[model samples]
Target: MPSTSTSLSPLSTGLARATAGLNLCHENASEVWHQRPPLDFLQIHPEHLIQEEGGTYRDQLDDLRHAYPIVLHGFGLSLGSCAPLDQDYLQLVKRVLKEHPEAFFSDHVSWSSLSHHHFHDLLPLVMNDETLDYLVERIDQAQELIGQPILLENISSYMRFRDSTYDEPSFINALTERTGAYVLMDVNNLWANAVNFGENPLTQLMEYRQSSVRGYHLAGCTRQQAGDGDVYIDYHGEAVHETVWDLYEKALRHFGPWPTLLEWENHVPPLERTLQEVSRITRYLNDLSVAPGAT
Candidate 1:
């Protein structure tokens, strides 16, 4: 069976020990591990894992799996969509899991489709009772079909509807309560939303269902002042901001050392750059742990 637990899965209560990773981008595939840096895992978007020849990377992936832990962070699941679960995609994911039973899977919490039309973006869902019930039902169905629990990620959104009755944390916690699923918290996305919507991330997300959050994602954002006002887009193209890094430290102080992933997609720097951030976060996490004989 597919691995349902993460390296720092919520099964443990105390502070997470030491888990850090980077997104598996094709750009750095050739120059991976500049001098073989220390990393705990690799966050993979399986859709991109396929070879250019339109064939799966069974051998290539298996070879890499031996060296590092792999976790699937997908974008196409569209777990919150009203449309029926994508059976073909689910089967593809299942095959992947079946081969690498140790690898875990997760997807965004936002909807990307309606009535069979895919929007190709992770759009925000209406955060209310109707949408909550709708999503829980879909997640329940998805879990049963996949035969494994999945983590829901908080994605970046450009707009928020007036119909959003519950705040992001409350809605996420509610979904976990009903579905028995875990959350893949994204610190960059949280910081972006707070900037765009005028909320305090340190306090606004203070009451998250900490026990259900096993991992986190941190990336760079691109800011823009549009007709709609200021916005911080999760461009994932630049180095992580100092502001976001400060917020991340607060989160580490508050939530303890959750397994954090350094994400770089668009303007991916050299493999060495990602390793530096990974080393930076790993060191910070080591420091975040309660010191030897503290108050």
Candidate 2:
């Protein structure tokens, strides 16, 4: 049977103790396949592996599963859309999960579609009671269809709608409270928003519900010129910025150690460099685990 727990599944619970992992990407597949790194678990995008020639480890699901526990992180659910859930997309995800019922699933809280047209980008939602109600209904239906809870991730926002009634943290907490879903807190995205819009990461951490946050994502951003100032884009191309690491450490202190994944998709680096970043996450988690007053 598929996992139905609102909290972390058995595999995710075990991986939380393991501390760190990497987002499975085709660019690093050869090295990962030839010499399996010491990853706690692997996060895969179902869309990237739905076909035999999808280039995500070149259709080696069986071989990869033998080495590590898997988790599904999707990008096409478009949960924030006003339209009904995409049955075809859901079917592809269902097929993958049917084979690995032990895996947990996650997707962004932002919308990416308008009717039949897909934006191919994680667009921000207006944080209001109406939007929240809409998302709650959509998430409920999605959970029912998938037969498991999902971790709704915070996407990096370049701008905010003036009609927003609730801040990001409040909206996310309310979503989780209403739907019994978990939060895939992406610290890099938080930091990007902070850099772009003066949002305080420390304040957000305090405002967020710790119990709702079940996992984390760490990635790098690109700073580009915008108007007179600069904008920080969640590019995931370079190394983790120093400011992001600071925020990540603060998150660990706030939420305790959880399963964290390092995402390096753009300008994919060498496998060694990728593992090095994962090592940094492991180090942070280990430090937190051994800290004073730790559980």
Candidate 3:
């Protein structure tokens, strides 16, 4: 049977400490309470929550659970690598899930490490039958060990494999069908690919297995023009672009309102700006629900 004890530990400790009046102040209490309208979800890096200093990371996670729904978005899982998945990384992820029972976990579909050497970037995967089978088997093992289905996200790519046998949508559709895992569709990635590769991102997204998508991600990109070719990098440092916003609206129509996370990892802005962007996405989703002709 699945256990919540393993997942609820961190939240329990955090809540206890928070209630002890340690960080509370008269001026900030109302603001904190109002903004803390049950965070839809928070994606955390494993390094931030998994520490060598013993209980500090665990304690911090416990406190975060009190105010927000936590999701473990791994930066180093490297699911599509030809090399075997890291056993130590998998064990750490399991421990985190056990510590935050309320958390949902996910990782990128791209690989970051090859032959045990870490590249620190989400590298594109070759879409082929062999790679598909390998990923399906690994996902099966991961699910067996973790006792829950995992979610995978599509990654942006600058180059395509010469030998790719499947398109991005077909690859993701097949993997989800074979492994029964969910998806975290990143809107910015879709837009970036469409702009760079001349593929209709909405068409690719429409080909996805609708039942497999659990959430969506929105982030900013950096646009550059070099000679006659233009490129957009998924920088996550600024406000979302109009093209990405349009794609997000399409996603809202296709998938309904699910958990959405606005990623602002670089060029860290004021807290208010980040909050405002999140609020804008939230309102956009809300408006979609009420809009006529919306499915």
Q: What TM-score, computed on C-alpha atoms, does each candidate reach?
A: 0.86, 0.91, 0.82
Candidates 1 and 2: which is better by lDDT?
2
Where model 3 places Cα greater than 4 Å from the true spot, the runs are 1-38, 51-62, 292-295
Q: Rate the local accuracy (lDDT) of all candidates.
A: 0.75, 0.82, 0.71
> Which wins on lDDT, candidate 1 or candidate 3?
1
| Candidate 1 residue lDDT tens string, 10-126 | 332222345888876666654553344567877667666543444334444445555677677888778877678888777777777766665667898898878877786899988
Per residue, candidate 2 scores C-alpha lDDT tens digits across 139-257 of: 87787777667889999998899999999999999988878788999999988887688767788777889888888999999999999999999988999999889999988888877
Q: How far off is residue 100 in model 1, in Å?
A: 3.4
lDDT of 3 by residue, 156-231 (tens): 8899998899988888988877776778888899889888888887888798887777778888999888569889
Is 2 or 3 the stronger prediction by lDDT? 2
Residue pairs of candidate 1 with colliding backbone atoms: none
**Span of ten consecutive residues with least summed lDDT in model 3:** 13-22
Best by TM-score: 2
Report lDDT (Cα) of residue 185, candidate 1. Answer: 81
TM-score, model 3 to reference: 0.82
Where's the lowest-lDDT run of ten residues in candidate 1? Answer: 1-10
Off by over 4 Å in 2: 1-14, 51-56
